[model samples]
Target: MPQDFVKIAQRGELMPGKMKRVDLDGRRILLANVDGSYYATDDTCTHEESSLSKGFLKGDTVKCPLHGSRFNLRTGQVLDDPAEENLRTYPVRLDGDDILICLT
Candidate 1:
């Protein structure tokens, strides 16, 4: 498949254990920095419309602030309750110092 990767942020823009919410092609994507690795997933919570970037990051899991739904950043799997369906995950990569995310 042809990948449409878009550079969303610089490496220095996001610190470890931090996350940022970006709007790409009118889609809400949550970019997370777990330790030194980068991960991307849907920004909206499955149960509620809360932004996952506003939530807390614990290891590779992110806890939803609204209703406490935890999701794995790497696999976008729901690790805790409140969310039945899994969030969509995107491929993330680095080019030099630019953080790129695959939208296709």
Candidate 2:
């Protein structure tokens, strides 16, 4: 199947160690720029549906602001409890300053 890549954010729009939330087709996705590298994951925390974009980014891990569930930004792995399910990840691509995400 062909992948549907969508331009989500600009390269430098989100600085290192920061995160932003992008909505595509009603799906909220969290975009994290960790030391110039980018990662994408579902914005909602699995534990209680809180927005992960409102959380804190530590290195490559994002801790849920509500319940403190830490998730690895690189692979969307649940690094801490309160969120037993891993976050869904999206493929990220860079084209010049355009940050694209594969939604499919």
Candidate 3:
């Protein structure tokens, strides 16, 4: 079986191109609003364990605050090195005014 939706925040709360950190169960999730869509990824930076939600966001890429490692917000892929590990992506859905993250 797979884990289902985890409520992160209200849709009206996060502005586009910004991110917020949410704790779901025991996992730390970085919830980002890119353009008009929402995305969820592991909050920890793949390299130095820095909080990605505090990192810089440019277009669809997020740069690690500690070492400049970049990651694709949509796919959670490692776009730049020093951060060799890919981020774990969570499925996101907009439920009315709430943001639902599928942990499955």
Candidate 4:
């Protein structure tokens, strides 16, 4: 079977209220740590093609730097206007010191 979960980050590498961008197998994924919980989503913004990892993470919401659009990190749902499409989310889990994200 193919690998289900891919390692995204290490513990302490990403703190609460922070987001990071990871590239794996030509895929760009946005990883966010909200209140000690992890969430993964597409790094590209739905509004503008700006990088969401460069955006701001407030609580469970992320604001795009290009158009200031906000999205829920947990569900990839847009919390603001200007973005009609929702982001694609991935399942995240912590395995020891490894922060894994399911791309499958």
Which parts of model 1 have CA positions greater than 4 angstroms off? Answer: none
Off by over 4 Å in 2: none
Q: Is candidate 2 or candidate 4 better by TM-score?
A: 2
Tens-digit per-residue lDDT, 1-104, candidate 3: 76578678998889998888998888999999989899899999989879998899998899999999999999999999899999999888877898998887
Model 1, range 1-104, lDDT digits (tens) per residue?
68988998999999998999999899999999989999999999999999999999999999999999999999999999989999999988899999998987
Which of the two, 2 or 3, has more lDDT?
2
lDDT of 2 by residue, 1-68 (tens): 78888999998689998999999889999999999999999999989979999999989999999999
Candidates by lDDT, descending order: 2, 1, 4, 3
lDDT of 1: 0.94
| Quality of model 3 by C-alpha lDDT | 0.90
* TM-score of every prediction relative to native: 0.96, 0.96, 0.94, 0.94
Instruction: Compute the lDDT for candidate 2.
Output: 0.94
The better-scoring model by TM-score among 1 and 3 is 1
lDDT of each: 0.94, 0.94, 0.90, 0.91
Which segments of candidate 4 are over 4 A away from where they belong?
A: 1-3
Scored against the true structure, residue 14 in model 4 reaches a CA lDDT of: 89
